[model samples]
Target chain A: MSVRHALLGLLSEGPKYGHQLRQEFEERTGDVWPLNVGQVYTTLQRLERDGLVESDDTASEGTQNVYRITGAGVDELGIWLHTPPDLTSPPRDELVIKVLVALRMPALDVRDVLQVHRRYLVELMQQWTRLKEDEGEFDFALALVVDSELFRLDSVIRWLDAVDGRLKRAEIEPPVAVPELPRLRRRLAVRR
Target chain B: MNVLELREVTKAYGEGMAQVHAIENVSLSVERGALVAIMGPSGSGKSTLLTIAGSLEEPTSGEVFIEGAPLSTMSHNEKARLRRQTLGFVFQDFNLLPGLTAAENVSLPLELDGMKAKKAHTIAMSMLGEFGLGDRASHFPDQLSGGERQRVAIARAVIGNRHLLLADEPSGALDSVNGEAVMRMILNACKQSGVAAVVVTHEAQLASWADRVVFLRDGHVVDQTVPPPTPEQLVHTAQQR
Candidate 1:
């Protein structure tokens, strides 16, 4: 997700100018994520400033200053690739928030709200599937992208089913309220 | 063409006092070259629906069709011949014969359908090779790994250009990674052969590989919808109208 690291990683391949870097990036990712030429150059400049990359003045063509990854850049890329992403904190998911807020409001049928979102997610999944088929027989990069989206949406749909099941059970048998008197009486008996 | 269709099909068991409807008024149609997934919790009639669709079991009342010909119109021999010729089933257990080699197991269905044993074996071996199992062709079922066995089962099911496939939890016994491989093989084979298929699976991830998913609940068709149109479909529809 970090364009900074992506550019640094690309530079590790060898010296590359602005346009070449953009083209290679798109080609490798099956053009699923497009990078702006200006953004690429700006990131390259920042990498040069931070000593992560250096411009090859000798290989420079007209308006095309080639950049190569420094020793430090190789180390940085290595660390980034080996480091595990921080997933301890949950992201701000709109669907989760909506379900929670709906649970508090009795006027809203939470199941109905969940079903609507579930349908939308399924539609998105189908759209991704269609895209994968369109990409043709041997598009590995696109296959990975489609698989990731489909798995994420499938997990969300499973969660909705879980919530629906729990709510249905709660309706059939109202959740029992914990009575405070039993604990107090048990404590007194134990003391006696 | 509709390779398989079930109209208002219902299957109930037992007498009045202990009657249980395994499937109730479930209508489904699968056209050639289509892959439809039937997903539901256990005992929700997923298997029942598949059995009826494949004509392995008859519905208590309702019409079943294969290639637009009503199943009820066929005699017992005719129905049996139809199934042997047009339908193939992949079971959760792999269902390969222990006495036969991988190639023999794959070739058995074709041989039973009256193809020459030598010719059937050759076709089976080639299909196995395509699935990266050519090396295991001579090995018996007990010698093959679980994934290999499942792959062989699939090869057998799709052999002889069978137009329809019914799979009951095809990936059930394999690990997740192997299960995914099996799923991809099924999808690729279906697309390549233009065979219509109905897969009964509890795994949602597997179901996502389907062209459309049909959800069943207590034997009822609770949800059924086709996936968004592919580019080929859009073009085909445009040409039609």
Candidate 2:
């Protein structure tokens, strides 16, 4: 669901500021859609601009900006929640795009992917151990997640080994590394 | 109506076979306009305590008051009506109807109580507006982002304006930004409307949003801290929990 609708929908229970809405969203959904705090305020600003939500005139002293959904927003949200929106084809993710390009880049990219998974598997295993100490059903869920991560990591690691053997048998030099300075710069800028 | 009350309450899940004690001698009170959080780990009996207090599921053995009267001897229908009239729930999952709009989702709780469509929708629309979903109210769940879905869920939960707000991981699916916003909004509503709230959360950051934070581990309140520590402490507590 759209964050905007979620914000407005939540306000239906009562009026709330931006920060409050973000917390409730996570609490209700089990951290399935973690929101950045800045995004919550930004979205609220947009909603207010559209007259979908209105904030109180009071000067709140917290990071949360006080806002409540507007009547128009309710009407619009009502329509959208019931009516099916025009469907767009699923967009390709970076993983798919990267994998497609990896095929022409020799087997090194495959090894890189394997490395990432191996690290992730280790992390998940660590998390699972810590979570079990807390004594909750989260352990059950984490176990499943850890299992999947390990399984994926194992598969990738195996594939990497196979690729290594094939390369050795072929006796071919590995692909030369290419500097991606521009791409790295763009990524760093985007992060900032 | 008193709705629910706990007197030095303690709840344990298993007997000698597999004893998993969920709550330990916890006392809480929920009247009208009372929203509460029973924050704890997965096995913590916060849910158990809530179910018993709400009279949805009985406590292993505790004195639960409903509507100024005792529910200890009430029938199933009596308890059901009590639940319908006094309590509303918001699950971690946004349980909105696929066919329903934002307003429709908000109106469900009231509608279930036999409120008319016109009346319910009117209230629902107002509720949606209150949360800020006005302009794109007609957009379906698919068209909405994660934050929007959560907003819809909150609206639906509060549409009935039930006195007690029992949210289980209310912001579980939201991003930190969205999650914080949701918590603030819930607390504000509870504060402004004087709805006593009990929100169950594993995140101390979220729990800090509450007026009081009673930390629970292994289904027991091991500590109670008012106000909060610095952001570091809150974060540390959350991570440790």
Candidate 3:
């Protein structure tokens, strides 16, 4: 799922510039992995540096730069095609991890994380809505996203209220007591 | 008679102070042509029971029988053979081959079992056509929509006439409308084919689709419904206050 290999794989099909790559990637994957135009260009630059891909920088004015997979890129793409892509080293899902950590942290700011998640869910809902409204028929990729991802987005929206309640309860709860605190503090004070 | 059964199934984790009885003395049955669901909370051991039934994992204790035969007696190859010939699975994730087209995914089991490529593709295409995805049969998994992918998985599962069709949270990934469509398709197809189904779900809506719904507590079947409700009944019950 590396943008690098995806870029190379697309280039192997034919020459494409950054915008073309971005558009093709979205259309192919059904936007399962959102790629920005900037990401496509950056990955193209890296691929060029690695010699896995080549680009003609001297394109005529008003025309986009044309990039194609190199010999090495073809070899790499072939290997990746046969092998299972390593998903273990995927980009960290900070939203999931941060909330999980917040659950562990004593009196953690659950409210803050929920607020952030709420904002993100709101933004995601807008994207899904716009996509739905703009498109008449369902493309398979978009259909999949509309079904599963929208449910996930909605679930997060619903969960924010639950998290807020949990945080409010935590804030109102009494402090924990330690039975041996006074004796332990006296022992430490003597040493100091 | 029970076509499939679980006997005093008890699964426990940890030892000494940490010992947790995940499933305790649980038993259930699935008759021929039945579509049953095992529903429970997160730590309720429904998944463990399912894995044991599917022969993917060994139970801590007790016996699992499919069509009156014991799973414990089977050797690895025997189990594999039985699974290949007699069982079909529909995972919530749809477990489709990413590179393969929908038709190819449906054809995999048949090919693996030594069916001719042309024959298998013919059969697979017919199944996809049944599910209204004939036109998209050539589309890869990534190219298909979520609902389409699930239907493809269902097609793949039932393609070979496997006796038992087991699904784990099959509709967990679908939207309400698409989920309803998948449920109807699965139930109707299984019923018509006379294939026994065991669906695992936490969602009440999906559980209702089962011919009979079984509720789990810890690891045991705590409750069971008789004369399984109709789809209309299920929906009415779901909407009840």
Candidate 4:
């Protein structure tokens, strides 16, 4: 999330050029998030401007500038590692919004809408599972990334199932109404 | 030829007004070397369809066939012999005999069908090795991990020239990692042995391993769709990128 802190942490190990930092960052994160060299260099420049890192141009010939973490950078990385991410406010989720909108629609069956999205999420999870099966066990970094994704998807699925159960218990049904347009009426009739 | 077929099959219980149809006019065919998964919510007749296909229960009406033979024409003993020789089953409970070692549990099916003990044991051992449980072959069901036990159950199901495998929530009792491992084993069995399979599961991610998925709703075949992509295809795409 914070590329600045991530670059600083990598620099804490030793002085490294932009290309080497990008490669190690990808390798450590299981290659899930790819970082371009340009982005790495930009972050380095920002870190130098903020006095968190020092760039030594004389160490390396040509255009390459080797950067190392300053004392301030070590303190920043330490604090970032110990601090927990903010989670007090719920993030805006499109699936949750879709369910809410479907509930208010007079002609739509909310259960059907839920099922459609549920299947899609399941398909996405299956793709990740396939990836995990092929390569996760051989590499610890990839395995951790895959496991984290699977758990995240599993939680969303659980939430969807819980919502479906609540709707069933409440016995809520969409209002029955004939569509004004002929084409819409025909589609609804076919679905029935 | 289709390894399993159900023609206009309907299974009902009770009588008159109280009669309930678990599956009504449902027809399905599973070809050899293909795997089909059935998905549905509770009480949707997924299990009923499986039982009827396996000849474990008689359909109230319509015909069931295995390997082109109608089940209606086979006597009880004949059906039993067919099941012993051609069909295999795995369940959520792992269904291994508590007293038998992994190798013995796997060999029991072959032994019951009149094979010599030595020959059965040899085949079972080879199958266990293929499933990566060679070292655990002498271990009892209780001694093995959940994943290992499920693999043994699967090896037992597919051993001895069995043509079809029917599984009902075979990974239900295991954690996600073990569950995925069980599914991979099942997929491997179907591909390598050319055995047809029908698996009924509540988890759609597990069901996605199948070549086709059938969705059931209130005793009806509501929908059928091919899964998104195969693991091989995904890997190939990733490599290309």
**Scoring each candidate complex against the real one, what DockQ results?**
0.24, 0.02, 0.01, 0.23
Model 4 superposed RMSD (Cα)? 7.1
**For model 3, which pairs clash?**
A140-B145, A144-B146, B23-B219
Worst-scoring 10-residue span by lDDT in model 4 chain B:
B232-241
Note the Cα lDDT for every prediction shown: 0.82, 0.64, 0.75, 0.85
lDDT of 4 by residue, A52-122 (tens): 99988676457788889999999999999999999745446888878877877979988788778766766
Best by lDDT: 4
RMSD of 2: 20.8
A1-192 per-residue lDDT for model 2 (tens digits): 588887888887888867778888876544435787898888888988999988886665754456777889999789879988766444354544554466457646553553354334333333332332232235344334433443554454345445535544445655466433226456657987
**What is the clash count of model 2?**
110
Which stretches of candidate 4 lie above 4 Å from their native place? A60-63, A172-192, B230-241
For B1-241, candidate 3 gives per-residue lDDT tens digits of 6767989877778889998877878788887788787866666788887888889987778889988999989899989887888888899899999989999999999999999999999999998998999999999999988999999998888888888888898989998777867776777666788888888987655655566767675566656554532324422432352
Task: Provide the global lDDT of candidate 2 against the true structure.
Answer: 0.64
What pairs collide in candidate 4?
none
Please provide, for model 3 over A97-145, each residue's C-alpha lDDT reduced to its tens digit, 9 standing for 90 to 100: 6776776776765655665565455444434433432341456666565
Q: How do the candidates rank by TM-score, highest first?
A: 4, 1, 3, 2
Q: After superposition, how far is residue B105 of candidate 4 from its true place, in Å?
A: 0.2
Listed per model in order, the count of residue pairs whose N, CA or C atoms clash below 3 Å is 0, 110, 3, 0
Q: What is the interface RMSD of each candidate, in Å?
A: 6.1, 15.4, 16.0, 3.7
Which model, 2 or 4, shows the larger DockQ?
Answer: 4
Across residues B1-241, which tens digit of lDDT does each residue of candidate 4 receive?
Answer: 8999999999999999999999999999999888888987778899999999999999999999999999999999999998898999999999999999999999999999999999999999999998899999999999999999999999999999899999999998998778878888888777888899999997766776677778787798867664667656754554465
| Model 2: residues with Cα > 4 Å off, grouped in runs | A1-192, B1-4, B30-36, B227-241
